[model samples]
Target: MLDQNTSAQLKTLLERLESPIEIVATLNGSDKSDKIKELVTEVAALSPQVTARFDGTNKRAPSFGIAKVGEQPRVNFAGLPMGHEFTSLILALLQVSGYAPKVSDEVLAQIKGLNLTSDFDVFVSLSCHNCPDVVQALNLIAIYNPDTTATMIDGAFFQDEVEERKIMAVPMLFQNGEHIGQGRMTLEEIIAKLDTGAAAKDAEKLNAKESFDVLVIGGGPAGNTSAIYAARKGIKTGIVAERFGGQVMDTMDIENYTSIQKTQGPKFAAEMEAHVREYGVDIMNLQKVSSIKGADETANGLVEVTLENGAKLESKTVILSTGARWREMNVPGEKEYKTRGVAYCPHCDGPLFKGKRVAVIGGGNSGVEAAIDLAGIVEHVTLVEFDTKLRADQVLQDKLNSLPNTTVIMNALSTEVVGDGSQVTALKYKDRATDEEHTVELAGIFVQIGLLPNTDFLKDSPVELSKRGEIVINERNETNVKGVFAAGDCTTVPYKQIIIATGEGAKASLSAFDYIIRSGQ
Candidate 1:
């Protein structure tokens, strides 16, 4: 049910509609269908022009078939529009009511000019913050093109559909029953994808099984540097990465990357890719390294890196530049409220909580940095740390303290994320020093605890790892195993900065070259 203020706002917004909007919900007597019908009815009752009808006997089981009245429905939703996805539902209603597309004129013109009869089936969860961006973008395109139909499939209510599609993440898109990419993307990016038709082609096969003089795992700054160094030596080089940008894609600001005064993560990632592509390095993106074997001379000497999809790459030497990711707090309600109110990347989701109070759970440099960056966008930031003192740099701490909207609370451990059924509302924490419990009422939570190396694939390998699970390496970037090396935050590098990682990657490539020369590979 809508509150008085929300109902008033909806009424006002509906008054702008020049035509009637009809929503037909197909139900199958499930609890999810009941909730969907209730929500649609509640929202439709706010305006005279808006109407909702429910059908309980439909064989579709549970889904919303929405379209303008007196026309065949072109849109379908399989889940309840709750959490951040409620915005998508509202936008769908508004668009059906004759709201103009929010995309640029160029994009709309390109979409309108499209001759392909496209069907976009988007899968999303209710709590996904990134889902609405993709849904709205696709819906706007559908509004522009009469031949295009956009469908929103809820990942929750349609568990079978999710499993069938092998969907591991939200915002997974499909074009005419073929799987596209995942995650939120801009309209321009989507259009470029459609124009290129790369996903449809690339999804069929990754690459031919090829051998390289040196192979670099991961695709961050370190991996790119390693590939370039190897390729420059006139050696057959290949770089296989899960994502081309690695963890660097999530980074919003970079000021200490040597000469660059300022750069965003995606921009830097694109630059790195462009630079790497200039060489003959056989770059394989979107492949996960499952395991490594036979690095020793006694066992064929060639290192074979196996992928999750049963593909393998053989190389004389392998450099592990797999990066690190943000550590999770692993508290209660964390998973349930993810993207609803519990968010990890401040740069990606901060704009959604504009003028809303939020909490940052950490006191390290990353935490303070997130707080500082979010302070300008959000109304207030409550920084919670388990340590008695903040571990961030003095400059960052000073900047954070200078902000009147920021509050630093030391010796506090985040215990749980509290939220309503639809969205997050507050955060619960415990004071380690006083043994007292406290709660902060906020709209969102930004977690920047620390870094965790993505090195689980090396657990069974002979490459020695530190107690902290980081690959142990010498100054020359050489691991204990022969012809195997590592770099970046995943290694025992003293400083986990991008510049240091890049240098280490270069050194690792040189070391691999030296090993190759000595071993006569």
Candidate 2:
């Protein structure tokens, strides 16, 4: 049901519709479908120009076909567009009603010049905040170019398509049936993909041994800084990463980055990318490292990095800066409700649940801190801890105790997430002491247990890793393996902040340079 305030806002926005837009929907009579239909009807009621037609007989549940009245329907919503995806739905309606997307003339010209047919099938969920950006960008391109078509497919509704593609993440892009990109991508990046058929065109499998003075294995803050520092020293530098921004791209607020009062993750990532690209470093984005061989194991007497795409590159020194990712609870409904309600990033998804009750699982520093931050925005917060007492600092516990809307539930084990087919509704847990099961009815659940280092790929290698899987590095960011260094959250660094990672990256690069000078290689 649309609130009074939201209904008024939608009514105001819908007045901008220049032409009549017909929304043809396919509903399977499910609860989610009924809700979607009601929502669409409510939007249609706001304006006589906007109307909706339903097809309840269609086998594909929770799907809708949208188009202008005179032209063919070129857009489809595979699931109910709620949460952040509602923006995409509204943008689609506006675009179909004859409003042009806000794209530059130069980009339009470049899009017009393309002879190839670009078909983009973007997989997204309703709760993903980053999906709308990618969808809107692609849809804008499609609107400007006759040869391009962009379709937003809801991952939850399109189970067959999702299973066939093995999509585990949102904002996954498929170009002409090939999985081209995943996660949030800029418009410039999509244009680049259109120009080059492959996601990592610059990282095509190398046939012969190509050596570099330094090779950075990740593209996070640490790896990018390492590459920039090494390139500034006039060395042959190369960086291979699954993604350019690493975990920093998922971060929403960055206040303690030194000097900067406030910044977001994506913006900081772009700045870092621009800074690194200013140097002569060869960067291979979206390339996953399959295995690595130390300098002694390589036949060419150089450390070798093998990519999942069968690319091989050798370097005198290798710096591993693969950052850490949020640890999953591995419980039922955790994976299914991901983004919809079971969110790992509090900063990124906190705003979506404003004024709604939510739970923060884990009573550690991150969990308690996230609870404190969310209590101010949300109606109420339930902090659940598995331990007998909160493991956070005393100061943080005291701060949490002061929040009026915050409820601390100690010695509770989260069992599962309770939700309908469309969205999350509540969380199921059990008391550790009494073994009494309880359910907390809430709109969202933020999991802040801990982080796991992204060094599983190095397990087969000779790289020395702690029992917890973090790479062990010395003060100079030098790993036990000769000519191979590690830094950032992936390493056993004392601090995992951005500033510390940047400093460690610089130290690793300088150490590599010193080793090269001493070895005369």
Candidate 3:
């Protein structure tokens, strides 16, 4: 199942095995089963520490399980682990063979302390860039705790199960046969869900921390850059975010960042987090700031940040890097059918609607690019644009127009997402030119409208904001508040590129430092 170069690479990676591993396969007299057998046999031949056995009673045929010798299999694969999932397969092998995972000590302890028995079945697509994170996270939990078991099921290979469960998105997780979550989720998020008391404990710990010299709110590219810059000044810097990596985690590919030719979103976010850690920046992930009080509004003359969990933190200066999120259509049935048929990330969820008709909402670059990409997978793509003309670049519009399976509708506004209480069946729109309404039958709707700044928490705060709800900032990225600064998509920046966000973050950090020095704080 692996090529020459792949086999050599696998052989080299397997040399790190600390103990013997057994690959047990459950197969039948089918082509897929035969392929699984060959894959397991080949993998076994790569290392003396690995052995293959083709006798098992798993109901899912053409499946395999990896485990250390004489131990129950903790991680199982229901289909061929190739494409984006090949890394998952390798991680499972090494982790099950007594190799430690690359997680923090606290996280490792939490996984090992879990005493309950739980089963996780993650449905994924091979082309999805976000699937590997969920797959590898569950595998790590399964390896550390013998009571937990995780199975990575490729949705493409198991179409019957996918349809039966009505799974319309990739990386959908089901715990003990009950739906839990969907889309991109990190290992920390998975644990936070499993551990009920984790949030309260984290809040208590955060409340007990001392005041920081520079405290950054949000964990996107801007927040990470701000924290790194502030920490490099030898100041006590702490960053709190709802989720590290922000919306970039949902992004698939990023090629616009200069110096780096191309990189995936999750990989780039991981690199950013690693770089921030090198500067000793206090990183707090999975924390949501409910509100902020500037030094002018606080009794102690210190910038005060409040968490959703009632945890209060004080800082000398604050940098607001809270980024933006995908704007919703706000029409009926959109919320009810989210992840059922309404998806935001095309690259992650497009494979789930193979050969089915779908609609792309928006006429800009993202929308046209999604339609063009989905044309090859889905039966037909209908691009609905509210504008009179397509706003995408000339080349992108030309390519989209050339696609035979794609249709573009101009001056149309999406009215409602029609669904049958489970999944979407059609979309309702109105023609601006004739006041006529229309409906298009489709299996999925991809919303790429625009972005809304994540600044609702600051609506009542002292920081000045623009009419569009974006944080208003001057040339130096300084907010109207004396000690507060803003940057990135949350600010009134013209462009929302990643590189621009980083530069703005650096400027905001420097501005905050200057404020601190001038004010003798």
Candidate 4:
């Protein structure tokens, strides 16, 4: 199954195995089963410590379990772990063979200390870039705790179960047969859900931290850049984020990032985080900021930021780079049918709607690209645009128009998402030119309108904001509030590109440092 270079790489990786490991598979005499057998046999041949057996009786055919030689398999793959899941398979192999995972010691301890016996089944599509994070997280949990088991189920291969469960999203997770989550989730998020006291303890620890010279509020490209620049100045720096990578995690392709020729979003985000780590910046992920108080509001005369968990962190200088998120339709039934039939990420959730009719809710580059991509997998695509003409580049518009399965509706306003109480059935829109309302029957709706700034927490603060809710900043990236600055998509920067955000972040960090030196704080 693996090519020459890939086999050589796997052989090199397998040299780190500390103990013997076994791949026990269950086959049912089918084409997929034969392929699985060949894959396992080839994998076993790579290392002397690895062995394969096809005598097991797992109900899921063409499936295999990876485990230490004599232990019960805690990590399982119900389908071919190729594509984005290839890394997950490799990690499972290494971790099960006694190689330590790269997670923190605290997180590792939490996983091993879980008192509950849980079974996690994650449904994923091969093309989804976000699926590997969820799969690898649960796989790590299973590796640490003997009572827990994680099984990765490829939705494309197991169509019957996906249909029965009415799954329309990738990385949909179920615990003990109950649907728990339906999107990308981190290992910390999963542990916080299982361990009820974790948040309280974490909050207490955060509250006890000493004040920082510079504290960044987000973990996107902007926030990471600011943190790194601040840390390099020999000052204490920290970053608290709801989730690292922010909107970048949802992006699919990025070719305009200067030196890099081409790269995926998640991979770029991972590399950004790794680079920030080299600067020794304290990073706290999966934490939400509830409010930000000016320097005068705190007794210590330092800027204060409060967390959703009631943890208050004090910093001399605060940099806000909260970033933005996908703009919602905000129409009737849109919220109710989210994940059921409505989705914002075409690259992540497109595979679930194969051979089905879908609608794209914009005419910009993102929407046009989504329509062009979905036309290949879905039966038909209806592109609805509020403007009179498409705003995408000429090349993209030409490609979209060439697709036979695509229909473009210009000067149409989306009114509502019509659903049958469970899933979307059609999209309601009105023709701007004729004032005629129309409905397009579809099984899925992909919203690619635009982005909304994540500045809700700063609404009541003293920082000035533009009419569009973006934080107002000067050329130096300084906000109106003293000792506070802003950058990235959340700020009044004309364009919201990753490179621009990164430059703004560096400028903001330098501006904050200058402010501190002038004030002698």
Candidate 5:
């Protein structure tokens, strides 16, 4: 129910939004083309007060925030007005349409009802595209309560700044400017982080939160395995993952991992997570490590992991299963609306989309594989390829073609993904030949692009990352850095498979144990 005051504010915002918003379309470094002028006129007519203008001043790279200077707003005219930013425009509309800086009673009430009003900052990188959903949820809280402001900064773009803050991974959250948690978190954990009560923290014994016996940085097969092992070994472990399952989470069917003929990706992830939980692992979901600084080893020879959370954790051993993320289109909205409708793994969220329509954006083996799998669940699967022909293996291509609900859109380029918040609605495509335009209504879009290692955080750390972003190590999966061992998709190994990651996990554990013995600990 809307309060009278809140309703009035929303209505006023709606009026301002309906009153013509200005957007200018311009081609950078080009002569003043008539097309630019015509489009600017079209945008001006949409907003009563907003006017479109193009200046040749050539704006600097993206600044901290959008700057407005005098009557003329800094002009950046993107020609064709298409692609990822399309949704950004929509978001701007909604934010303004519902704008009431002071917020409403229900929201205000929720704020007053919070366990804590302290602010938490989460820093993330574009590489960790799986994080937008987490950031958005935090942003929602910040909306209702101005005391907390959760903002996401591109770690790569602001590498120096992130380093200053000691950020090692993406989606890492800070609690009251302190390190409250890391990795994946249940709703309960989230509320705990939001907890302002004194009793709960005392019961939870957060006084020991600053110390860890083992710090496991990946939530995939290896990291999960290590966490379970460490917890059983009676060493408190903190597992940090951008998303709990890493690249494997993006994978569909897992017939390779031991003990199961075949299983869904997320189910496997959940099981691994369960195994760790049964042993009481301190797992922080959606947690990204921004940086790692170590204190002197304890008397027992445990390495201390000091994360960007401003908390110092004493861990005897650190496992590097930090894993990798899918390679993206590098377009705008891809980063903004990743989990909303744009997904990476088909199997994890595929079942929830039964009978819905969707599209797959790659033509490689993974792309074809995703389309074929999605066809079984979704009503229709449109496979869009930018290249002239499919690049997947002939066998996979044949399988994709055999699927009834799958349609191949070759020689097409996906210029834009349009959606209405909660889910994706349409995808705009363009042809390279006759310049034909195409659009398809899709409920979900899975990107079968590729992957990159999450090693940007190990910059000055002792860990040695491979050229391809995999952690460089010896035959035992041990890195050049002492007391550091890496495994899984982020390692310098060929053939990315679940079984391989698990094997490496066992190997890494054994090696770590051996390292401990050799030191006479």
Candidate 6:
């Protein structure tokens, strides 16, 4: 039961409520407990102005049903209602009840088709928040793109997935075919690549496949470093990506990435790309790599690279830097209107939704970052998560709470994305506490939940795979497959950072050179 202090706090929060609010009752093991009933009644009495109901089976939760105000507001609670729990629940209620919450329509337009298909995934690091702009940008795009939904998985949380995808850096994206793209890209840039240009969309898919000296698949920090190193070493290096900048680009500010104290993912990615140009590396942006197969060992040990565009190439070594993807809510209409109101990658698309209202999925660090970032870029930022509490550290949680424009909702799952062909206008989610469903109006959505690996390209290969699906490699950065070296997020490198990737890339180059020399290539 909530103490007087807690109940009083809830009452105080309700005073500002202009709309209806849901207050589901907490469910306990007891089926015939009067205590639960009394608790529910007490809570309702405390916030008579706001709505209060029970959790599972008509039992009273502190806050469950939507209020009867002008707008029905709903807040969810998955677990028992206690300490600091009410804060999250209460905030969600207020957000759902209110309208126009100081958000901009332009920003809302950017995030129209979020909650689309479960195709898109974004990965991010803790230390890579550039003024919270990265999260804002992603929130805008997630609102619109439904076929390719967006999510921000924790770089450290998904260890097995990271290893499997060889993710050695933060802020990456993983799409279907296990093809990964890293770096910071604007919504326009991301959509352009995913849309499939003339070559990739209309051409015949390559079955046999070709190869390259350094076919750095994926364009995250690790892949970027691999390309830079390969190019610098005078080897034929090519960076193929759905777009550039990988997941790092999704991060607005990067304080932990070495050399640069504070840098946005997009800027960092552009600089890295520029540096690679100095070394003459081939950057195949907006290209799709479909399959991979081995070639007969030539005297020069040539590898083949086949593209979805029917283009092919040959090289001596291959570097796999394919990244990861984000998890989804698996709700209705999520796949129907992608990119219309739904988005991921707050940094790339947040500006488009400036002064607009948006919703963020997930309660982890990435979600926290998104809310904080979007608060600055958009008029109002709504953070939604199924977890009972935020998974982010205390400092991050505190920062999120302090943001005036940010409202966090816990113990809720989006059930449907309501909108038409052009964009998303509202969101419907289920309250885990009371099992009641409610809908709220919003312009955009951003998903920052979790990640999935992008290693489908290596399924048939002889490269030794770990149980987690990451490529097994020695400290030297050479893969079990000869002349086929892997590095960056594509390898099971211990650390994921720009500096670390640069070192690994350098190490990989040296190893590749040694193999070439020993084989007399």
Clashes of each: 0, 0, 0, 0, 23, 106
Error of 2 at 33 (Å): 22
lDDT of 6 by residue, 1-521 (tens): 77888778877876777755555454455532345455556666776565555543422222233333442222222223232223334544454455323334633443442333434455554444421222233333433443433334443444445545544333456664364455444554544454444355334333333444667777777777777766776767777776577766555567886566897666787787777768777676666676654434444457666666677656677766666556566787666544446777675455445566889988888888878877887899888889788998899999988888888788997889888555678889989999999887886788787665566667777777777567778887777776767666556776555677667767776777677667775
lDDT accuracy of residue 281 in candidate 3: 92
Ranking by lDDT: 3, 4, 2, 1, 5, 6
lDDT of 5 by residue, 14-80 (tens): 3555333344333343343454555455434444554555543322222211112232222121222
Q: What digit string (tens of lDDT, one per residue) describes model 1 on residues 140-231?
A: 77776777878888766776765455554567788988977766675655765676654443434454656789999999989999999999
RMSD of each: 11.6, 8.2, 1.0, 1.2, 16.6, 19.4
Worst 10 residues of 2 by lDDT: 198-207
Q: Write the per-residue lDDT of candidate 4 for residues 1-521, one digit (tens) a residue.
A: 89999999999999999899999999999898898898899999999999999986777887999989988788999999999999999999999988999988998889888866889999999999999999999999888877888999999878898888888888899999998897888888889888889889989999999999999999999999999999999999999999899888888899999999999888899999999999999998989999888886777789999999999999999999999999998999899889999998888899999999999999999999999999999999999999999999999999999999999999999999998887889999999999999989999999999999999988888989999999999999988887899999999898889999999999999999998898899
What TM-score would candidate 1 get against the native?
Answer: 0.66
Over the full model, what C-alpha lDDT does candidate 3 score relative to the true structure? 0.92
TM-score of 4: 0.98
The collision pairs in model 3 are none
lDDT of all predictions: 0.80, 0.81, 0.92, 0.92, 0.61, 0.61
Error of 1 at 62 (Å): 30
For candidate 2, write residues 139-204 as lDDT tens digits: 767766656667788766676666555554567788788878766776656776676544344456
**Model 1 deviation from native, Cα RMSD in Å:** 11.6
Flag regions of model 3 displaced more than 4 Å.
none
| Candidate 3 structure quality by residue, lDDT tens digits, 287-341 | 9999998899888789999999889999999999999999999999999999999
Residue 409 accuracy (lDDT) in model 6? 81
Error of 5 at 478 (Å): 1.6
TM per candidate: 0.66, 0.69, 0.99, 0.98, 0.54, 0.55
